[model samples]
Target: MTALGTYVKVWLALIALTGLTVTAAGLHLGSLSVLAAILIASVKSSLVLSFFMNLRSEERVFKVMLGVAMATMAVIMLLTFVDVWYR
Candidate 1:
């Protein structure tokens, strides 16, 4: 529990960031709103994954694994969209 205090601080910071993201979404950025939200959400997710999951100090291979998973998902989603739009 030695690092408990640091963990709490990080969580609080993440929460604040999340709040900012939500508030920004409400400001009507038009087409950029969802992009901004996704960007912020990705950052917040990185924080949660690295700290809350204790993956920050993990091996390089683990980082590669996460990247690969993200890439695969992105490719799949984009392909589906392309298929729908090009049909």
Candidate 2:
């Protein structure tokens, strides 16, 4: 498919994900709500990074760096959650 077509598809997917996030926020799922929101947000951010940021065409090193950064942030978030849960 053409670049324009691909962008339009991604834009539509982003909009749909945004709607899902809003719907998820309105639900009363307790602690699971936070996890659900985070998962949705992660997917949205990945789409933005891959398409809007043009990371798909970038070099392997850039992709590796981004993956490492994401992994680090995930670890930090997990640690914070664990600390909170044990307190």
| Structural RMSD, model 2 | 2.4
What is candidate 2's lDDT per residue for 38-80, written digit by digit as tens? 9999899889998889888889999999889989999999999
The lowest-lDDT stretch of 10 consecutive residues in candidate 2 is 1-10
| Alpha-carbon TM-score of each model against the true structure | 0.85, 0.77
* Candidate 1 Cα deviation (angstroms), residue 31: 1.0
Candidate 1 lDDT over 4-70, as tens digits, reads 9878988898989889998998999999999999998888888888988877888988989999999
As a whole number from 0 to 100, the lDDT of residue 10 in candidate 1 is 81
| Cα displacement (Å) at residue 34, model 2 | 0.6
Candidate 1 segments whose C-alpha is farther than 4 A from its true place: none
CA lDDT of each candidate? 0.89, 0.90
Best-fitting candidate, scored by lDDT: 2
